[model samples]
Target: MTTTFADLTTMRVGGPIGRLYVPTTIPEAVDLLQRVAATADPLLVMGGGSNLVVGDVGWDGTVIKMATSEFDIDGELLTAAAGVEWDRVVAAAVDAGLAGLEALSGIPGLVGGTPVQNVGAFGTVTSDVLHSLSVYDRQTGQVERWTPDRCGFGSHRQSVFKHSDRWVVLEVTYRLRRGGQSGPIEYAELASRLGIAPGGTAAPSDVREAVLALRRGRAMVLDPDDHDTWSVGSFFINPVLPEVPDSARGCPRYPDVKGVKLTAAWLIERAGFPRGYGTEWGDGTVALSSRHTLAVTNRGGATTSEIMKFAAHIRAGVEARFGIRLNPECDLVNCSF
Candidate 1:
C-alpha cells in the first residue's frame, strides 16, 4: 500500500502517493535528490508537513520527507539541519539560556521551513535571528550557503525559495544571543499575558511559556486530541497592503515597509466568518477552527475540495465585505482554492 500525503501531513487528508522517501542521513537524501533531479517528474523536498495542502488525488511525483536531525550549538550560534523540529530548537535555546527565539516558541514545522515564510509570532521573526543557510541546488548539483539578503524575505510571508522549488534547503544557521534575557516584547497581547510592559524584556524561559500558553489557547500549538489543532496553522496570511483602503477604516492594521499589514484573523471574523463557523457554512466537512478563525480545520473526514470550497467562501466573504483579497498562507501542492 502506498503511503499518501494523508499519512504524512498534520491535516490528515490526501490521496495515495507512489513513494515518500525519508532519508536516514544527509548523504542519502542528497543521493536520492540527485537521482530525482535527473528525471522530469516533480520533486518535493518536504520537511514537516505543516504548511501544505495536497489535492485529494495526491501528487504524481516523488515526496522527499526531510529526515536529517543534526543540530549543534557553538557559543551563541545555533545550527539546525532542515529536518529538526522547530519547537524543539526553541526549547533547546531556552534551556541553553539563549534569547531572540523566545517569542517564536510554539511554531510547528522544521528549521528549513522558517526561511521560506520568515515565520514570526508575537514580534520576533526567523529572519531577525537567521545568520545564513545551506541549500542544495537541484539544477547545479552544488550545495551553497546563502546570506539573508539573497533569501529576499518579504512582508507577512514570502521568500526567493517560497515561490521557486529549485533550491532544497539543507540546514539553517541562526545567530542568537548567549545572554539569558529575552528581547524586547513587541506584541502587546504577549506582553500583557506576561505582565510586562511593551518593549520590556523577560527571561527566555518565561517568554517561551507565555508564547506556548497563548498558542495553546488559540489551538495554534499541535494537540492530537483537539480537532481544532488539526490545521495547517493560519490559513491566510495577513495581507500586507500598499496602503490601508479608506473603506477598511476600522480594520486592525500595522505599518510596515510594504505599506500596511492587516490582521487576517480580524478580517475574517469581521467579514462574518467567526470561530467554529462551519456545517451550515459548507459541506460540513471543513470549518473555521473553534479556537481560531485563522485556521481552516478538518472537522472530520473532510476532502481537499471541501476545504477549498469552505476557504473560498471565507475569502469571497472577506473580499466582498472589506474589498481585500485574502491570500492563503498554506502552500498549495497539486491543488488550488
Candidate 2:
C-alpha cells in the first residue's frame, strides 16, 4: 500500500513510498528486513517518524515501521521492543521509581532511535544508561545483543550504526539507577532555571518537570498547532572547534574536531540570523523558530528542498563569519548535500 512520507514525518513534508511494512514480532521484522536487504531492495527503517525529512519526490523503496510491542522489566534493567515510544519508556521507569531517565522524559521518537543518534537532553544521553542491544546485523544476518562499548557511542552519535543501513535495532536494554532522585545536574541553564545548584540532585519527577517546562518555553516540546515545533529538534550538532592559532586567525579556519565544541545557536546568533530569522515563509521557505534559534521550521507549506535551502543559508552564514560549518543533527531522508 502507498503511504505519503509527509504523513509519516513530524515535518509534515515529503512524497510517498513504494512499500511499507509494519511488523509486530521479532521474527517477522527480521525476516522481512533480511529479504529486502538480500534482494537489494532499498529500505528505510524508522521509528516515531519524529526525526525525518523525506524529499518531496518520495522514497522509491520499502519502508519498515517497527511495531513490535513486547517489553519486560527486571529490577533496574529494562529491555523494550524497538517499537516502544521513548517517552513511554521513561514514564515506565519513573513509575518503577527508576532515576536515570528522568532528564530525557519528553524527547519524541521510539526507543530504537535513541541509540542510533545517542539522543540526549538536559546533559543526559541514552548512551549513559545503555547496557546492551538486540540488533539485526545485515552483513552476517545475525540477531544479537551488543554491549555499551560495542555500540561505539560518542557525543550525540554511535559507531555500530552510522553511515550504514545495515543493523536494525529490535530491542534495547538499559541499566537504570535505583532509589535515587536523578543524576547530578550538569546543565547550567537547566539548573539555574530550576533554582537548583549545579551538581545537586532533585527528584526525578522534578527534573522531568523542569525539563518539560524549559522545552515548552523554547517550543522544543511538540505541539500540533505550533508551526515552530514543525522541526527535527535541534537542526545542527554543536560544532567542535580546534583551538585558534594566531596564524589561522588571519584566514578562515573551521573546527578541528579535536578541540572544544562550540554551540551552533551561539554562532548563528552571532552571524546575524537571530531567532526567527528569514522572511516569514518566503525565499528559503523555512523560518527559524521564533522561540529558539536552533530549530528550523516549515512555515505552513515547505518542501524538503526549501527547508534544506534555508539550512544551507544558515550554514553558509555561520561559516562565513565563524569559519565553522554546522553539520545537521537530523538524518537526511533521500537527500544529500
Which model scores highest in lDDT? Answer: 1
Candidate 1: tens digits of C-alpha lDDT, residues 214-306 = 999999998888889888999999899998888788889888779999989988999888899985765677888999989999877888888
RMSD of 2: 3.0
Range of the 10 consecutive residues with the lowest summed lDDT in candidate 1: 279-288
Pull out the clashing pairs in model 2. 242-256
What residue runs in model 1 are displaced by over 4 Å at the alpha carbon? none
As a TM-score, model 2 comes out at 0.93
RMSD of each: 1.1, 3.0
C-alpha lDDT values of all predictions:
0.87, 0.82
Model 2 error, position 193 (Å): 3.6
Query: Which parts of model 2 have CA positions greater than 4 angstroms off?
Result: 155-158, 244-257, 281-285
